[model samples]
Target: MSKQVIALAYDGRNAPSVTAKGDDALAEAILAIAREHEVPIYENAELVRLLARLELGDAIPEALYRSIAEVIAFAWYLKGKAPVGFGQRDDGDAPLLLSGPER
Candidate 1:
């Protein structure tokens, strides 16, 4: 209910996992850690509310595939690639979460 923050982790093969989440002060800590780590931050209150219900390490719900896919793709585009070490292979041509390059 309080200002919430949810963090997800993804590899190019599997569904994204809910790696971290929190409310209120914990939410602030999550955001701070993300900033300190240079992690991409996505704001979608609707989606956050939905995802926040998920437990840590739980892959996103199938119903959220399309929405989450869009978010990942957008994040990839914004970053020019998935953030380093986010399951990015050494191959150097890895697309965002198994998705082909964004044209």
Candidate 2:
């Protein structure tokens, strides 16, 4: 399978931003860094594709809040960290961001 990885950074101040993205070699490199740094990595092809469409450093769009929130929640669970509210909840529902080691 081809390697597809997208890196996101959420500081609880602004919307989450896509920080990096790559395929093949660069994708492998991204995974390597995550492994070395103990960053939680979640493999979601659909999500990766959506995130890949974002320009590096662009905050995720509103339409993606719910989906991305879910990803963050899962990552937090995996790393044993609590999921925290992310920015604002458009639907007036609970939204969470993943918290873990450096993203």
Candidate 3:
């Protein structure tokens, strides 16, 4: 099977959308751009298979929300970012720091 890759974009307010998808050479290009930009990469063949069914700019189906959410959360954790209202306080922008799994 050709190596497949799917990219998703989420705005915290809406469902994640399929921003890109490709196989083989196209996949390598997409992944290279992501690496150059320091975007975290998550690998799951099954998830990619499911997401590949979506067209570009299409929001993910509700059934995949939890699975996609987990991937997004993992990416956020890898980037050291927390979603708004996540352990925030009234004082300022200080967010609660949680330990991540060992790499």
Candidate 4:
């Protein structure tokens, strides 16, 4: 069976956003979108720290570009999908993207 692949986006500060694709197609689509928008992408703990300091409705800081990228990339990896751009999802898949290292 084909596993549901997903794509994720975020404001680089708040929670992650997610989307679904049939397979790796979603991940590729996400990369393309990021490239088109000239947005950097990232993955790992650095992403978490950067996202932590952001507040909803606050303006995105210029310095946080890399961090935002990392968060988006990480979200993709976590969901076994790809980075799309900047948005969030609330479906069952949402938890997977929002999940961080178990503390």
TM-score (all chains, Cα) for each model: 0.76, 0.75, 0.82, 0.32
- For all predictions, the C-alpha RMSD in Å is 8.3, 7.9, 7.5, 13.3
Q: Tens digit of lDDT per residue, candidate 1, span 8-102?
A: 87776788888777777777877778778666677777788788678987989999999988888786766666555767533232222211111
Candidate whose TM-score is highest = 3
Model 2 bad stretches (over 4 Å):
83-103
lDDT value for candidate 1? 0.69
Per-prediction backbone clash count: 0, 0, 0, 8
Q: Itemize residue pairs with steric clashes in candidate 2.
A: none
Cα lDDT tens digits, model 3, 2-90, are 66788777877788888877887788778788788776788887778778788988988999999887887787777667787786323
Query: lDDT, candidate 4, residue 18?
Result: 44
**Total clashes for model 4:** 8
Better of 3 and 4 by lDDT: 3
Q: What's the true lDDT of residue 101 in model 2?
A: 24
Q: Rate the local accuracy (lDDT) of all candidates.
A: 0.69, 0.67, 0.70, 0.42
Q: How far is 40's C-alpha from truth in model 2 (Å)?
A: 0.8
Candidate 2 lDDT by residue in tens digits, 1-103? 5667788876655788877777777778877787787777776677777777788889899999998877876766666565346443332222222222222
Q: Tens-digit lDDT track for model 4 on 1-103?
A: 2222223445434644443222245445545665575444443343444444545334336676565455545545655554344354432322222222322
Error of 4 at 80 (Å): 1.4
Cα misplacement distance, residue 32 of candidate 4 (Å): 33
